[model samples]
Target: MASTLNTQLHSISFAAFILQEIMGNPREDETPQSRLKQVGMMSVLYIMHQGHQPLTISNLVEITKLTRMGVSEVIEPLIARGMLTETFVKNSMGRGKARQFAISEEIFEKLQSFQMR
Candidate 1:
C-alpha cells in the first residue's frame, strides 16, 4: 500500500484520456492491445497512489485478485515508463529485504497536476 493518510484513488478515465491530448491526440497507429495495456498501467498507478503500505507484487496480486504473472505484466511497463519505483525494505529480523513499490515521485507529481485535454 502506498496511498497514505491523505491519499485516495484518483479516477482516471482511460477512454477519455486516450481521446484527449495524450500522445498528441488519439493514435490511429496504436493497437487495441496497446490501449488495453495503457488502461491496465493506469489502473495500477491509481492503486499505487492510493495505498498506505509499501506496495509489493504480492500485495498487488492480492488487491487485484490477479495471478502474479498478470500483475507483473502490468507493472513491468510502468517501471520502464518511469512511472513506478521499487525499494528494498529490510525484514524485522535483519534477514533478506523485500521489494516494495510506489509511484515515482516525478510521475506522481505530474499525475497530481494533470488535466484532461
Candidate 2:
C-alpha cells in the first residue's frame, strides 16, 4: 500500500514538473493552438516518464487520443530538446521500420531526483 501511494505521488509530481517546464512564462497573447501544443507536449512527457518500454507514434496516438500529426509535432521537439531518444525497430515482416521513443537517460535520472524531493 505504501509503495503504491508513493508511486502515485511521484507520478503526480513528475507530471506537474513537466507541465511547469513546458508552460514556462505565460504570455498575454496565448492562443488556443499554443495551449493545445503545451498540453500535447506535457502528455507525451508524462507518458514517456511512466512507461518502462519505448513506444511507437501509433501507441502514443492511441494512448493520448491525439491525432497522428499532433503526436508527431510534439515528439519532434522533444527529441530535439534531448528530452527523448528515438531508436529504430526492425520490422522483419514489413517493408519499413518503425521508430520507438523513450525518455532520455539524463532526463530520467533528473526525474528520479526530482521525485525524491
Candidate 3:
C-alpha cells in the first residue's frame, strides 16, 4: 500500500541520515587519529549493540569480514585511547586465553549524543 511504501522510504531516509552523521560530523574532542579509529571501532560497537555477545578479536574479524591483523590494528588504538576496554579470560578448553572487547562508558555516552541530523 501507499502507507507501507511511505514507511519504508522514511526508514531508508533515517538510516541514510544516521550514516551521514556518523561519517561527516566529528566531535570537538575527536582527534585525527581518533576519527580514523572511530570508523572501525564504531562498526565493532554497532555490532555489539545489536546483541552480539562475547565480542572478541575473532568475532570482530568474522563480523566485519576483516582479517585478524586488520581487526587488531583497529582495536589496539581504541584500547590505548580508552575508547574501548578489553578483558582476558582463560579459554574454556584451558589451553589458551581469550579477550573480550567492549566500548567504554565515555565513548558510549559521546556516541549517544551524536546528532542524527
Candidate 4:
C-alpha cells in the first residue's frame, strides 16, 4: 500500500493523493478544473513547507502563493475530515488570534509511511 501510494504520489502530485486517497471526492460544486487549480496550490504548500511546524493561513498563502480564500478552500476540507488540526494562537501584542494548522497525528503517520517508500 505504501509503495502504491508512493508511485501514485509521484505520478500525480501529493495533493492529488491526499485529496483522492484520504479526503475522497471534491465538493459537488467543484469542477475538475477548479480542483486542479487547488491541487497545484496544495502541492506547492506540501512541497515547500515541512510539516514539523504548524503554519498559519498567511504562511500557507506565502508558501502556496494562493490568496487567503484559496488557502481556506484547500484547508477547510482537510480540517473537516480530521486529517488536519487547527489551533488558535493568541497574539502577545493584543492583536487578534491567528489559527495555526498541522496535520493530524494519524494523517501525519500515514504521510510518513508514504515518504519512507
Candidate 5:
C-alpha cells in the first residue's frame, strides 16, 4: 500500500513538474503556435525520458499525437538547447533511418533536481 502511494505521488509530482516547465506562466507576447510548440516538445521529452531506448520521431509522433512537422520543429530546438541529442543508425537494408533521440545526462540531472524540490 505504501509503495503504491509512493508511486502515485511520484507520478503526480513529476507530471506537475513537467507542466510547470512546459507551460510556465505564459508570456504576454507568446502566441498559440509557440505555446503549442513548447507543449509538443515537453510531451516528447516526458515520454522519451523513460531512458529505455533512444526514441525516434515516429515513436514520439505516435505517442504524443503530434504531426511530424510539429515534432520536427520542437525537436530541433531541443537539440539546440543541448537537452537532447540524436544518434543515427542504418537499418538492416542499409538505408539511413530517422535518428533516435535521448535526453542528455545534464537534462536528466536537472529533472532529478525537480523531483527533489
Candidate 6:
C-alpha cells in the first residue's frame, strides 16, 4: 500500500510538471493594439483603484509614467473609437482645465472577452 501511494504521488507530481511546461509562463502580448489598450486600461484602473477619484490626463501620465504626447496618442485613438468618455474639469491650479477620462463599460467588456481568449 505504501509503495502504491508513493507511485501515485510521483505520478501526480509528474503530471503537474508536464502541465506547467505546456502552459509555460503566461505573458501579455505586446501587439500594438494590445499594448495601447493595456497602457490605457492599466492607467485608468490604477487611478480608480488607488485614488478613488476622477482621473485627468496629467494623472494618467503620472500613473503610467507615459509622456504627454504618448498619453495623447493613446487617448486620441480611444476617443475616436468611442471606447472612452472624457469630461472637462476645472483645474484648481487656475492655469488650464483638465479632462477626466473614463473607460466605457462596452470597451471594458470587449477587453475582458479578448483577454479570456
Model 3, span 6-97: residue lDDT tens: 65554454445434544577666666665566565665565575475767877777788989887787777657656568999776577899
Count of backbone clashes, every candidate in sequence: 6, 0, 0, 0, 0, 0
Regions of model 6 farther than 4 Å from truth: 1-51, 105-117
TM-score of each: 0.58, 0.70, 0.57, 0.59, 0.61, 0.50
lDDT of 4 by residue, 1-104 (tens): 98887656654545656667443576676667666655564555455444454467877777667799978987776676565688999744468898877656
lDDT of 6 by residue, 19-95 (tens): 34223432343345644454445446444634575667787777779898777766765555464678887886978
Ranking by lDDT: 2, 5, 4, 3, 1, 6
Ranking of models by TM-score:
2, 5, 4, 1, 3, 6
RMSD of each: 6.4, 3.6, 6.4, 5.5, 3.8, 13.3
lDDT of 1 by residue, 14-98 (tens): 3344324233433465555754665665566555655555577777777788797887776665566565687888754579786
**Whole-model Cα lDDT of every candidate shown, in order:** 0.59, 0.69, 0.64, 0.65, 0.66, 0.57
In candidate 5, what are the lDDT values of residues 5-116, reduced to their tens digit?
8666655665565456546755565566775676556555665665464477777778778898867877775576565788887643577676777767775576568667
Clashing pairs in 1: 1-53, 2-51, 2-52, 3-50, 3-51, 3-52
Please list the residue runs of candidate 4 whose C-alpha ends up more than 4 Å from where it truly belongs after superposition. Answer: 1-16, 22-24, 27-29, 48-53, 92-94, 111-117
Can you tell me which runs of candidate 3 are displaced by over 4 Å? 1-37, 109-117
lDDT of 5 at 59: 74
Scored against the true structure, residue 85 in model 5 reaches a CA lDDT of 82
| CA displacement after TM-score superposition, residue 49 of candidate 5 (Å) | 4.0
lDDT assessment of candidate 6:
0.57
Better of 1 and 2 by TM-score: 2
Model 2 C-alpha lDDT per residue in residues 1-117, reported as the tens digit of each score: 999998787777667765665566444555556645755665665666566545787777777798988788767756765667899886445778988877667855877897778
Give the top-scoring candidate (lDDT).
2
Lowest lDDT 10-residue stretch of candidate 4: 45-54
Whichever of 4 and 5 has more TM-score, that candidate is: 5
